[model samples]
Target: MNKVIRIFIKDSTLIPVISIVLGLLIGALIMLLGAYNPIRAYASLIEKAFGDLYSIGETIRQITPLIFTGLSVAFAFRIGLFNIGAEGQFIIGSVTAAFVGIQFDLPWYIHVPFAVVAGGIAGGLWGSLAGLLKVYRGVHEVIATIMLNWIALYLSNYIVKFFLIEPGQQRSRILSDSSWLSSSWLSQLFDGARIHYGILLGLICTFLFYVILWKTRQGYELRAVGYNPDASEYAGIHVKKNIVRSMMVSGVFAGLGGASEVLGVFHYQTIHSVFPGHGFEGIAVALLGGNTAVGTILGAVLFGVLTFGATGMKFGAGVPIEIINIVIALVIFFVAASGLVKAIIDKVKKKIISGGSSLPTSQDWKKGV
Candidate 1:
């Protein structure tokens, strides 16, 4: 039993799972304090998220963009950078995709790919601006990214207003059908749940993220730079270039997410006074996922379920949806404080080992047979 406990404690994957469990338990406690039945609330959440085909399809849709943004943040973290500007990149990508989708007249094969790629490129460029600022002007990426996020937001709204707006609407013109990523068959199957091909793209990107980070020479250099920049520089790696490239790549993931939202779900872009929050949520996903491709997907699924099911708690159990937000915040807090949890576990392990292996005292020796 001691050996089993030690082994379980050593497994890093268990940390996130434990954090989630702790968060849920604390949330339940809070609910009880508020005179709410957490069990029924959670049951309603699950039922709303997965009860029928339509619910499942919508949940998957929610998961799809999260997968992209999670990958974006995770990829940046692997390179020792914080990409706080994914919101900006996403906006740029969406606007770029909208432009292409509205302006281009081509077959579905060409239009779809073109519009998506355009969005990615635009986002990549937008993200690289921060990298460039960091490398050349000595600006920290966090500050640069935060500033860039506002710029991207305002710029996107301007573009919508001047070039793409549909007459009196605050949204851009609808994309041409050729550029749409929606699947008629899938929609029908899900009973008009608005499912699309973007989820498939998200899965493909996850696989690519794994391959690029684990199986490529460039990945090695990026990881090396992240581990020790001076050592990487001494080893002939161009750290500056890699930094810029990493940010660009990170932006591409976010941009693709934005494009997916436009082309697959909404088919139009809205002028927003504030961020859509996907990028910020992505940070949470990345942390929960431990910055791995598969982990990000799982984290995205968890977040999707929680977010989509918040409505169920509201309507079925008469619990305030704000409680779910509190639960999510608690989850993040637990994840962030995982080092303390590890310390506690280590203390227990030491006590167990010490108790099991204490030297026999003089009294014990005299009493021995």
Candidate 2:
């Protein structure tokens, strides 16, 4: 019984599962209130998410950037920084990649990686700018990053208009064929799939982030510094340096995500309507994932599925897809107040373990503080 209790308390994946399940349960309640059949609605939702080739491809496409964004947010959170500028960083990364993607013509093998890596570097620099201001000048990242986002939005628009613009058009010229990631490179098994090799890049990055956070010395120091910076300073960790570096890493992850969207989905420079909600979505994903690499990826996929399925819920049952956002909000609320949920669950689990007996009286509960 103690072992089971400990496993429930310590298993990282269990909490996120509970959060998601609770969110879905609450969503069903909302459906019930709307006079819609909740089970049927959910069934339709699943069908739409995986129904056909095009649906599956689109689902994968939507999930691609999420993996990067989720990891980006998760990485920053581990260092106690709230990186609200992921949207800006993400757009800048894409803009940088687009410029590089079209500026020079090289072999596909060389150009693709070059464009992608350049995007990451550009994003990292952008993120570090905020980090630098935060650490050196005592400016809050939340404020600085948000301001930078507005600057980035306008800058991206101007760049696309003046430099990358196609003569008189809003968009740049089509990227060279060599720079494109052809679906033909995939085997006939996924023959008509629009899912590209960018998915592989995201997955590889996720794994590397996992190793960095869990198996490396730097990871230990990062968590320590985040938890108690004063203590970490006394313990020889450079808290400020770690803060800046972590944010830079966060931006790189976001940048890579932007590249995935541009190279895999857009294929050319675009402006006037750069939708960056995905970067903001990563915040919810990170919260749900509990800031672990594996957990973050799972959270990203779950969100992708939710977003994918919400459209069907909207069209089929006349339900607003915004309800999905409500569900996410509820999950964040509970996770932020985790102590309450944990205490309640502990009471139920203890009761079960004791075969319905009451826990020891208060007078008998002096084992540990």
Candidate 3:
């Protein structure tokens, strides 16, 4: 039992699970204080997310982009890079996809892939700029990415407004049917939900992420650089090139997310005055997932349920949507503070182990039992 307890406490996966439970409990307490029924609210949230086919489909739709963005962040972390500019990369990809989908007329087999690839290439190039700055000019990735996010926002808007805008609309023109990733059968199965092939693509990317990181020579080099750049350089690895390559690959994941949203869900790109928030949310997903490929998918699912269920909580249980936001924020906080949680778990485990084999007490010594 003591051994089992120690193993459980030492498992890194326990942290996020505990964090999620704590967040939910705190949220329930908050709801009680606000004179709302937490159980009912949660029930409604679940029902809204998975009660029926339509809800399940939409929930999956919500999860798809997060999977890609989470993979993007997780992939970068494996190479010791902070890809804060996933938002910018995603935007570039979306606009580039929209442009390709609109400009070209081709068969469905060719057109869909062409547009997706265009988006990925655009995002990769955009992300590589930060890598270039870091390698050549000695700028920090965080700073470069932060600046690039704003540039991407404005640049994407310009491309939409000037090149692809629908007349009298604030969004780009719709892609041709050939470029649409939607399957009529799938849509009908989900009762007309906007779910598409994006989720499948995200799963494929997750597999690739795992394969490229753990099973390939390039992945070994990237991990080596991440573990110790000086040693890797001493061992004849091209540290600078790896940095650029890491960023490019990370950007491809985010870019694919953007392209998927345009090609599969919305079928058009909107010129936003602000970010769509997927990139930022992805940071949380990556953190909660411990930057692992499978963990990322799980994290995305948790977030997807919480996000899509917020509406149900509001309409079904009369809970304010702000409460859900607070709950999510608390989850992020707990995840960020996982070191403290681990320490607490460690202390408990130590107590349990020590108690099982503790020295005799003074009374026991005197009695000589």
Candidate 4:
């Protein structure tokens, strides 16, 4: 019992969990302040997220892209690089996938994978541009990536307008059935829900990320460089190459996210005046997940549930949907403050220990304190 308590106190995962719980408590308080019943609001949110087959499918649909973008940000973060242009990569990937989906006529097996590959390649190249700029020009990645996002946005918009746009429409041509990832059998199973195979693909990628990062020599090199580039360089590791590789891989995930959105849900690309917020939301997911594969998956799911259920809260309890956004923002804030929270927790634990507490005398707990 003591050992478990000590582990729980020191475990990194506990911070995020406690942060989420606190976020929910604050959300409930907000509901009360707004003269709304918190219980009904929460119940409604729960119902809409998991109450029925259709709701479950919608939650998964929302989770699909989140999983991809979350992984993209998390992968870059693991390399000690901040990738703020996942939105751009995602946009380019979607356009590329839509281009392939509409321009080609092939069998389903070939067409689907072909579009996916095109999206991934497009995103990878876009991400690599930032890396190249950082490596050769001494430009900061944050500035380079931010600029590239606009470039990609305008470039993709031009491509759509001049080349791929339908003659009578602003958006690209609708994708062919063969290029879609949605499954008829699965739709039927979910009572005509929009869930697709993309969720499974996201799960596969999550596992693959864990395997590649933990089991591959290249991954070790990337992590080592990220941990300390100067040290790695002195140790004869190709730090520059790893930086480029990490950015490319990060873009691949973002691009796949955009492709999944097009192939599984939207089935076409539309003109965008602004970056879709998915990329930015990914930063929150990566941070909350501590940049771990399993943690990212769980974080994405939590966001998915909140997103899918927010409308239900509005309708069922007369609570504003924006309150859910507030809740999410608070959760992110708390996650960002985990170090401070842990310190306070440790201080409180020490106070209890000095006051004749039943705490263990283990080195782990002491170090945590």
Pairs clashing in candidate 4?
Answer: none
TM-score, model 2 to reference: 0.87
lDDT of 3: 0.88
Deviation in angstroms for 65 in model 2? 0.7
Q: Is candidate 2 or candidate 4 better by lDDT?
A: 4
Tens-place lDDT per residue, model 3, 1-369, is 487775443345767888888889999999999899999999999999999999999999999999988998888888899999888898888889888988889999999999989988888898899999999999999999999999999999998999898999999998998998887888899998889998999999999999999999999999999999999999999999999999999999999999988999988889898999788878888988989998999999999899899899998879897887788788889888766666665666567666555433333323631
Deviation of model 4 at 365, angstroms: 8.5
Q: Per-residue error at 1 for model 3, in Å?
A: 7.9
Cα lDDT tens digits, model 2, 87-129, are 8888888888888888889988999889899999989999999
Model 2 alpha-carbon drift over 4 Å, by segment: 1-14, 167-170, 185-188, 272-274, 343-369
Global Cα RMSD, each model = 6.3, 3.6, 5.9, 2.6
Clashes of 1: 0
lDDT of 1 by residue, 1-369 (tens): 476765454435656787788788888899899999999999999999999999999999998889989999999898899999888999999999999999889999999999999988998899899999999999999999999999999999999999899998989999999999999999999988988999999999999999989999988988899889999999999999999999999999999999988999999999997799888888889989989998899999999899888899988788898887788888888788876655555565576676655433333423641
Q: What TM-score, computed on C-alpha atoms, does each candidate reach? A: 0.91, 0.87, 0.92, 0.92
lDDT of 2 at 124: 92
